[model samples]
Target chain A: MTEMPATEMPATRFPKEIAPWDVIELTIPVRTDLVVLARLTAATLASRVGFDVEEIEDLRLAVEELCLSLVRNGDDGRLRLRYTREGDDGIAIACTFEAAPGRGLRELPVDDLSIRILDALVDEHGRSSEGGHKRAWLRKRRSRTVA
Target chain B: MEQAFDISEREGTAAPVVSVSGEIDVATAPSLRNRLQARVAGGDTTVVVDLAHVSFLDSTALGVLVGALKRCREAGGDLRLVITEPRILKVFEITGLTEVFSIHPTVDEALEAPPR
Candidate 1:
């Protein structure tokens, strides 16, 4: 696959204190078969955040890309996801794995295609080992229309 | 709470056609690889993959298609794809696969297009 240069995207931070009502959490086994649960949750949250239909679909697809990348390389574990609402601006979804054993942070999908997809779909996409937690995340902003 | 991922193929056409429905992710992409590989190994390199009914597909699915495309070209045949879903199409467009494979909006169109 041909590698495309990474496109620089505007980064947004997840809220410091997301209200309980502004967040949704789900923990599921790191199985490819169950990643659909994450996609479903993404759609629901995007809709609640006032994302357009097409944007909601993009969010779902973006979430699928992130979740599948984690589950495929991960061993027996649980994927914990935190969906934080940035008020009326956008939504940020972060995923981290609690590995069963021999757990190490796997890099964000290295496939050129997966990287391109993530770059195109979300405003911020990345992987990190912050505070000893292997985390992957993507943040999408609702498209704003001006009259 | 059922996750649907199904594939149906018919070899009666000049080029066999595989119609797939539901999401195609890592878990189910192998099924797609197996079907396409079987057809190619059986000497049917010119196959039509219809993804009209499929609403979602990811990189794993893309990898399977790329592999099949390589096998088909090496055998003097090609894999024509019918994908009308904009969301799925965007995946191809994003990854530059739009230029790599022969994509059509309909099966009939894909079947009639000249092989790449």
Candidate 2:
């Protein structure tokens, strides 16, 4: 078979390169003692994206609140956290249970205190399920600086 | 006193333990708040909060501390803190309260430190 001309040939394009620290994944036990790990990681990523001090704190608390909610309702499971950068303005932290094979995500218990605290702490907060994994997410935007 | 946590004051001193030394999260923050509120309302401003024994605190705890700090400042005094645990101090650092509150390694230093 004769090859097509270069103009008629299809070119392969690689996927876009992900920025450094654009995406981070952490897996830890679903234990109360380990919630601090999530909080510190969230705060560090938020700071890297230029979030102000107060915003960093807000994200830190939001992550802590969410993680505690998961740990309280869970038992001896593993938690998977995905930190994805949202443009250059902020960060989004998504949490899910790393359940065993053939297992469904447990019902996460969100107390009144957690609800009220999260409402006051994060820019966006909610839960979602994709494929099979269930995820709870909270997003925080970098505070705009005064001129 | 053996419930979620305990709140006590040093004898013969106007300073109340705004610290509420325990895991001061949503479950225990109210106790700390009530103690701080009572002290400030009782005319005990510029209190010494010894959180050195505390290992964990959340935003609710932070809010309670902030509220107490505001009330103290309005009364022409301030809220000083004694925090030795790095984990506990990290909460204040991340929240930017490290700059707002006068933090010391010891209660005596916190008590003796000048107010902002």
Candidate 3:
């Protein structure tokens, strides 16, 4: 893969309340650039943790699904993302948007065919309500093997 | 933000190859389906689709693939796919297409794979 120049990537900042561990959060306005950024980030994370090609692919799919979900339901102007390390080979990613009728992930169940595939790809995934904000979180644990 | 679709046809020793690139979204899928249909109608049955550059594929895009598969089978031709990118391949897997279509790791491999 060609190395993307640092200048090609835009500078971004997260809300003051977001933690420093959140890669996606630090890269706010990740909506339009999700496809490429998510794939690149997954590839980097996978390589860092020594994941196989198929495992890396699975991580890309999970990130794509998350981005798709956020784009479909997120607030128009900006969205906040958060990530935290869970354990060896595991990372938790979350995106918070305004709490509105369609914005609630409680109604955005993962029963669909796409979501089912995403569920199989990740170690753990769910959504939580924190009063004013709803967060969809997915835990990805790097796999040495493709399975 | 990008070209909706692009097609390039090359004549191999035995089969004709059709390379498709870019997003296969709701708005762009029809053009892709039409391109394949036109090739199948032109009596080119053994057509291979190179999807290495495709960034996204939705349900409508899968429908086009299935339709092309059916059309090729009816016309006594074969439809094969060359997919190296994980993002596009994930769409095929999510749609249970790995079992339906012959997927090749590289375009050269797909071109060399024996016709069905």
Highest-DockQ candidate: 1
In model 1 chain A, where is the ten-residue run with the lowest total lDDT? A1-10
Clashing pairs in 2: none
Highest lDDT, which number? 1
| Model 1 residue A27 CA deviation in Å | 1.0
Q: In model 3, which runs have C-alpha deviations exceeding 4 angstroms?
A: A1-34, A46-54, A70-79, A96-113, A127-135, A144-147, B1-7, B11-15, B20-46, B51-78, B83-95, B104-116
Residue pairs in collision within model 3: none
Which lDDT values do the candidates have, in the order given? 0.82, 0.71, 0.63
Q: Say which prediction, candidate 2 or candidate 3, comes out ahead on TM-score.
A: 3
Q: How would you encode candidate 3's per-residue C-alpha lDDT over A81-139 as one tens digit per residue?
A: 56554444656566565544554333343325445555678866655555555455667
Q: For every model shown, what is its TM-score relative to the native structure?
A: 0.89, 0.54, 0.57
The DockQ figures for the candidates are: 0.81, 0.08, 0.24
Task: Supply the TM-score for candidate 1.
Answer: 0.89
Could you give candidate 2's per-residue lDDT for residues A9-127 as a string of tens digits? 11112234557759999998765557768877997888888888777767877887767555443356778998987776767777876666665666654554455557777776776
lDDT, candidate 2, at A80: 93
What is the docking quality class of candidate 2?
Answer: incorrect
lDDT of 3: 0.63
Give the poorly placed runs of model 2, Cα more than 4 Å off. A1-20, A100-105, A130-132, B1-56, B59-116
The order of the candidates by lDDT, greatest first, is 1, 2, 3
